[model samples]
Target chain A: MKELDPLLHSQLRLAIVSLLLTVEEADFVWLKEKTEATSGNLSVQLDKLSEAGYISVRKEIVGKKPRTTCSLTPKGRDALNEYVRTLKEYLHI
Target chain B: MKTDELTEKESIELISRMIEKTRNEMNGDDFNSFLAYGYAAVAISIAVWLLTHFTGNDMWCFGWFAMFIPYLLSFFKKGKPEVVTYMDRMMDSVWKVIGSMFGISLLIIVVAGAISGIIDFSMMMPLSIIYAGIGTSITGLIINEKWFVWTPLAGLAAAIWMLTCGWTGGSYDNSWNLLFAASFLIYMVLPAHIVRHKISRS
Candidate 1:
């Protein structure tokens, strides 16, 4: 069995990647709403994903407000797919 | 649900839940563009039918130009997408392709009218309905829109019936316009009720 990536083994980060995989890109606010995560926690997890180069984060100002958006990088997608494959193997389904 | 740690089974469940949640967000403006184009097309189809049926003049068929109403209205329909889903782009592309087809069909009708001094949209009408069906069917599949999965097949059946009537001598003088009117009711307005139900519940 392939070992899961430690970086994505946590709950919030994996949830973020899963959401990003489904969307083209997601703003920070939307991610918070979906994950029901505190702003502080979501931001920290997002930073970890960004540092892993698993997801790309873009910050810009819109209407005098800072807006942060996240999208899965190609590496992120590969990691997620491999993770699922490994889980399937473990589940023996 | 957000959390710090998870077992393998829990991770799998998290992925499933997150994907499902995002799919729900695929609503993307409650399908504003679809409803806008659908309603406009239905209204215009009825208008063309009314004008042609009552006037008994081919010139009245010019109301087909009114189908462009949705294209113009698109600029005014506003909804900001917070998270852009892949379906949003696919939905946009499907309508764009159908709009181009509508443009090409209009060009053909205009050229034909200019040459003959009368617009006879015999085949064009059915073709337009077929195009409408294609757009909705693609959209329905992308968004998990239930009505779309089957409505397009119904619309296609209607269009084919129109073609059969038009090709043979069985169709009335301009009653296909009324047939168009009825088909648009199915193609466009029916989805409105479904959307309305969702909005009220939500």
Candidate 2:
């Protein structure tokens, strides 16, 4: 089995990626709300994932309201799937 | 602790809390707004017909103007602010613009009908209402919202009712109002609520 990066193993980052994977795309606010993380915390984790090239960010306006949206990159998706697969193997579920 | 210094567990907990808070904020406002517009379109259309029948006045021109109110409210007010995300706003805007186009078209048709005298002015009311429904439903389909299908279906039913029942023969009876109410309640009101609920959850 391929090893998962320890940096990607953080619980908050895992939840962020997991939620994004299910929804395909989500806003920073959505991620903050969904994962129940503080705005500052979510931002830091997002920056980490973005630096790893696992996620992409886009900023745009919705009805004169500014918003930041995030989507999982191919690498992020692969890493998430691999992480879940490894966990499943370990749990034998 | 500063967010940057917080452990992973704290971050996860915070995000989970925000999602729950936002979800609770989802009221039936959008759903009700849609229903209000749907009902207004039908009611105003019928009211114009009744007024014309009694006063022998050309009130159909005013019906078109009445229909514009709900459409404007939906576009400018409901769901405009809370949809903080860009994609969500884009999707919402697509529906709004489509609805506006229909309103404009219906206004044009009403004016043309009034001027040309091609059809009885009384028929204009029901026709305008039916057209509004058609426009809403088409917009719904364009946005892939299953709830929107009901508007057109209700419009079709309204059109059929208007055609079969003669205008002078108590066609604007209480039963017709009941039917209008039922169509809006079941088709527009219920489905819109369901869709809004789903969007809130996601």
Candidate 3:
């Protein structure tokens, strides 16, 4: 049986990635709102995903405010697809 | 649910929940911006009709320019959405094209009138109503909003009905103005209001 990607097996990281799958990109505030993650925790989690090359993070100044946006990379998407396949396999169809 | 880690079943479930949540959020984006334009289209059509019919002055038909009011209001709408979904981008791009087409059609009318100097605007209203209907119906299909599909179809049908049966005389007939207004009312205003009401209730 295939194994789930450890990076995506966690609840919050999986939630963040799952949300990004349906969108082109999402910003920090939006993700925080949807995931109900604390700013500090969300930032740390996002850093891990970015470090893994599973997601891309961009920071820019918009209207005198710092804005951070995240999008799932193609690598991340493939990992997600693989994770779901593994889950399905473990369940035996 | 736990903040981290999940069983196999839980992982699957969480993914499903997040996807569903994103879809719901797409629907939850306020349709008020669209509704503003829809109602404006209906209102301007009627006002143009009334003014032309009563004053016997075709120049009053230019009142349709007031559509810029809602267009500008929506253009300057403040703040960014928390998340911009694929659906959001798609819908925004679609409407931008439709609005551009509407503008291009106006350019056609203006250029045609400028060369001739008569400025007969009889075709502009009905054509624009059809464009609105197309945009509304397409959006309904993309978002799976049933009323959005049906209402615009009804509007398109009304527009066709008017084109064939509603017109009484020639090119300058005043009835076109009223028909233009009524079709937009059916195509855009009615469905928008209905969907918004349902969204609010739910």
> lDDT of each prediction vs. the true structure?
0.80, 0.61, 0.82
Q: Per-candidate DockQ versus the true complex?
A: 0.64, 0.11, 0.68
Q: Write the per-residue lDDT of candidate 3 for residues B147-196, one digit (tens) a residue.
A: 87877766676567656653655354677777676777776777778888
Tell me the deviation in Å of residue B62 in model 2.
4.0
Residue B94 alpha-carbon offset, candidate 1, angstroms: 2.5
- Candidate 2, residues B72-184, lDDT tens digits: the string is 66566633342243234444576666556565665676688788975334454455446556655764665567777665686567767866686447444434444554565
Worst 10 residues of 1 chain B by lDDT: B26-35
DockQ for the candidate 1 complex? 0.64
Candidate 1 residue pairs in clash (backbone atoms < 3 Å) = none
The interface RMSD values of the models, given in order, are 1.7, 6.7, 1.7
Top candidate (TM-score)? 3
Off by over 4 Å in 2: A5-7, A60-66, A73-75, B1-30, B78-155, B161-182, B190-202
Sliding window of 10 residues with minimal summed lDDT for model 3 chain A: A1-10
lDDT of 1 by residue, B106-132 (tens): 788889899999766666778888998
